[model samples]
Target: MALAMTDASMTDATITLPAIAPRHARDGKLRRMLSRMAILVITMVLVVPVGLVALGSGAGVIALPYEMFELARRAPLLFPAHMIASALVLLLAPAVILTRRRPEFHRPLGRLLGLFVVIGGLTALPVAIISHSTPLARAGFFAQGLVWLYLLGAAYVAIRARDIPRHAHLMTAMVAVTTGAVWFRVITGTAIALRLPFEPVYAASAWLGWMLPLALVLSNPRAFARLLSR
Candidate 1:
């Protein structure tokens, strides 16, 4: 009699619970794929144009137009150095993000990645100001550089304090900032390709670039938190 009552209660409880929808699983897989594609696209954008530009500049082919070339010439070494550092960050960030399961590898690689972030951010400030197409562009990029360094510093402090959760949040934010370089290229390239107004697009890219990635990271905080916990 007791076994029967228990069985009945179990059945009633199961029936009272809402049914799981099949579509939810598919939707989750789709979201994951879309996120991965976003990262892949950003990676390609960073690798291709930046690589070509670096090579062209090094070879003295000057693929950029006369006006842009003139601006680039202002801090010729810094521009290439910044681009190289950006590429390194792009490459290392994924490894660092994915290897949370392997602390042995992640720690050393993460330290190296942090170095790239510092180099990239520090170099970006001077280029932003020196190559100012407009006051808006200059201010936007300068602000980006500042924010990038701040987040990196915060993450470093968090880790030093052994605040794992805080460190995870700040590191996630820092990586998102690194993707801003790719977003800047994508936005600016699309605008130029479409023959839209330059200043408006460049100015917009400055903000959208970093903000987009940050939003993506924040939107999936739980997943990031899980990774960090691992």
Candidate 2:
């Protein structure tokens, strides 16, 4: 779900053109390998600890870092239910990513992933609507849930029609939104760590977390139009 960008290394080596070309080629290939490895490492970091903490909080074995939600006091279990289901989405994301590379396993894992998405989205919608946050933040949060459900549904429709490319594009967009939870925490957590103003960052994260990723996925408007049209 969380894809790390490729890191290109710069060198100050003085060299002749004859040797430089081959060296650069080797460096390019190495960079690509490192990029893939970095993506996996980041995906793991996004999933494992965060997912476990959320899941543990729901189980009452760990404390939630934020203030008590009004929803929690009212229902006693609804907040935990939301967190646990969201945690499942994060934990299961990697398996879905990996299985996509394997044609035989892809459909089965996709079905499982879809099941969790529905549960997660269902649990999140109510919490988002009644969340104790600024109105703008709430709207952004609510939109995230709605868009998550919508894109995934679109993806399922695309695949059902045997439109592989459209399905892949839609799934890519859905994954971008799915990882917004991680991005939200990352943005706010960094702001907290830096002793920056929390309120603005928190509110901005609500939209930026999902929108930024989705924007990147759809950066080429014409290509994206074609993708959706298919």
Candidate 3:
């Protein structure tokens, strides 16, 4: 026979539900490592080709070549300068983010990343100015460059003022903008490979690439939050 508990009996009885298992610490670290590696891999695949094309297009340079060579041939200094610095910005942004907790490493890498950002932003102006593409495309890239420099400057001020949280957010946003270059190439490449219309794809990629990344980063940067914040 089952005995039903009275109200007094039930009040005196202790009830325990099953406890939820905590996530393992190593699992989190491994996830972070994997995420960082994925970013680096994407950076290598996209940015490296530009670097190679920029560096190796000279008569005797003898490097793995690509279409950006036209830029190398055209403006020579301006295009190549923008590309190389932009590549460095893409590469070092991750490194700087990853090294946030390690002041010893972060300082130097952050400085280097900032320098490249400045160079890349400055050079982008002329490249955007001289681009033969439609005015909309030129304006998009020019605005992107301006925004990049603005974010970099703002982040610098935040850090200088010891506003760690604001600095973290700004730097992450800046890094997202830096990664936009990679997204730009990816979208452009995919569109071309699919035989999509050129002008529309190219022009859209100019803004969409960065805007998409910037939106994603601002919305859910928790994946890299550990690295993004000290």
Candidate 4:
């Protein structure tokens, strides 16, 4: 009787051990799945605007004489820096995508992108201040300059602290802001496609593209609580 009771207890423990381990493993798997889904959804949201801008009437329809004239007319003193920054930002997109799989490639590529952002911001700042564009355009340019400054500062801090999370957050913010032009074009194209009113839509899109991600970062529970408490 005693031996039988001991054997039963040992059996129960053995059975329960596997069950407990599996439960924890399942929880971890679920968490990972959710994280991946969040990243995928965000990626798609960002990618769609860029893809549309590159494919639609925005920059894609190059032969449209009126569009060319408009682009040329708006090409201000900061146009060259804007073009360079825009090109670098676009180039970094592929690197970022590639880094999703090959994370080892991320640091070097990120550092390069950081350098480009700094140069872009420094060159573009003066132009933005002196730009004689609409109030909205000036605001956009100023916002972009601030984003670039943040990116540069964040990258420096990340390097100093060896904090990957901070590095990623800053890079995400940089991409979000740098892609405003693409979003602007996308909003305009989308409006035209849907036969909706254009001017308001474009303005709304530009502002949202600049503000939304920053808002998301700020509104994150961890960050928000800290910010609000302070």
Candidate 5:
């Protein structure tokens, strides 16, 4: 009787220990995944905009003549607004990168970024409409404007509903749109460096910025499954 009781107690201990161990292991794995995700988000927040600006500032070297010609043709009233909008975007790029970790700073700065996008869109879209730039350039600017508007509206909704997931999605979309400016330079630079056909490369790069993010988000397993069923 004594031997049977001892064996029963040992068996209960073994089963309980194994169950507790697995739960703790699962919790640890979840924590590690969350940490990794946080790091990735931080890196993206810092790198994308700043990297674009650095590339864009360089493009200004090659594009200066064209920009100057555009300025010469524009009304004085329109020029300063355009300059201000451009400066705001370039300056805020770094500010946004630096403040990503501070929610207090991040939220307000994000609002400002959204406002800048709207201002830029309003100022640039009409110019793009009439400009003699390639069709792709015109379409890119217009699409950028539309995306900025959507991003602004989505940001407002996210804040109102206090939905973190929605806010993240919208912000990611905004980043993708802003990245068009950078990718433009990159594609052009590559074409020039490699002595490839510049026009087609430039045109494709403009659209690819928007298309890549759309492809990524829509291709998510869960999102794809839902769309297929619908």
Candidate 6:
């Protein structure tokens, strides 16, 4: 009778442990999926306006890339290079973030993204100051560029020091700053749609483009914490 009871207890323990294991695995996967969806949704929200503007430009609504070329025509060649790099960063950063599923591919793509962000931010500083129309706009863009560079540098240092959690959060922050390039266009487009005054709209966008994303991070620390923890 004693041996039979012990065997029954052992069987119950084995069955319960396996049941808990599957639930934990499922919970982990669900968390990862939710986090990925949130990041991608935020990314699309930022990119859609900029994408529409680009499509319109290509269709001759805004005047192609020529309109931008005209604005920075007198600026150094770096201005165009910066614009191109900005476009690449917008495309690559989200991809880097999403490629978490396949770390082998993620590694190469991540390097490409890091390279573009560094180049884009560095090139933007000069273009913003020398080529932008208003003093306020220039200052705003310059500050955004500085924040982008700083975040990317911090992320690199974190990874180098084997601080994975710090690296993850900083990279997310860097991506947020990169999206500022997109948000600038979106804000400008909204202002135009509203027929608001050009100067104020442009100036407001310069600061808001970058600040809003950081604000979101600060507001939802737990979501970001879980994402990096994973």
| TM-score of every candidate relative to the true structure | 0.77, 0.78, 0.77, 0.62, 0.63, 0.74
Predicted candidate 6 versus true structure: per-residue lDDT over 1-230, tens digit per residue: 99999999999999999999999989987987887787678667757456455445433365545536665576546765676677777777767776766879888998888888888899888888776468988899899889989988998899889897778788888777777877777789889899999889988898998899877776776678777554
- On residues 1-230, what C-alpha lDDT tens digit does candidate 1 reach at each position? 99999999999878765444546766766766776777577556674465456445534675666755776688788876676676677677778877877899999999998898788889988888888468887888888889888998999999999997888898888888777866788899899899999889988888888888888777888876644442
Error of 2 at 183 (Å): 1.2
In terms of TM-score, the best-performing candidate is: 2
What's the lDDT of the predicted structure labeled candidate 6? 0.77
Residue 218, candidate 5: how far off, in angstroms? Answer: 5.4
In terms of TM-score, how similar is model 1 to the real structure?
Answer: 0.77
How much does each candidate deviate from the true structure in C-alpha RMSD? 4.2, 10.8, 4.6, 7.3, 7.8, 6.2
Two-way TM-score contest, 2 vs 5, winner: 2
For model 4, give the 10-residue run with minimal summed lDDT: 221-230
Better of 3 and 6 by TM-score: 3
What root-mean-square deviation over C-alphas does model 6 reach?
A: 6.2
lDDT of 5: 0.63
**Which ten-residue region of model 1 has the weakest summed lDDT?**
50-59
Order of the predicted models by TM-score, top scorer first = 2, 1, 3, 6, 5, 4
Better structure of 1 and 5 per TM-score: 1
Give the range where candidate 6 is weakest over 10 consecutive residues by summed lDDT: 51-60
User: Which stretches of candidate 2 lie above 4 Å from their native place?
Assistant: 1-32, 66-70, 220-230
Candidate 5 TM-score versus the reference? 0.63
In model 2, how large is the Cα lDDT of residue 154? 96
Native-referenced Cα lDDT, model 3:
0.76
Per-residue lDDT over 114-214 for candidate 5, one digit per residue giving the tens place of the 0 to 100 score: 77777766766776676666898678767776776777688679978988656656655566566566556667778899999977786787677566755
Model 2: residue 165 alpha-carbon error in angstroms: 1.5
Q: Candidate 2's residue-wise lDDT over 120-181, tens digit each?
A: 77767777777777888888888998898998999999988999877878777887787788
- The lDDT of model 1 is 0.77
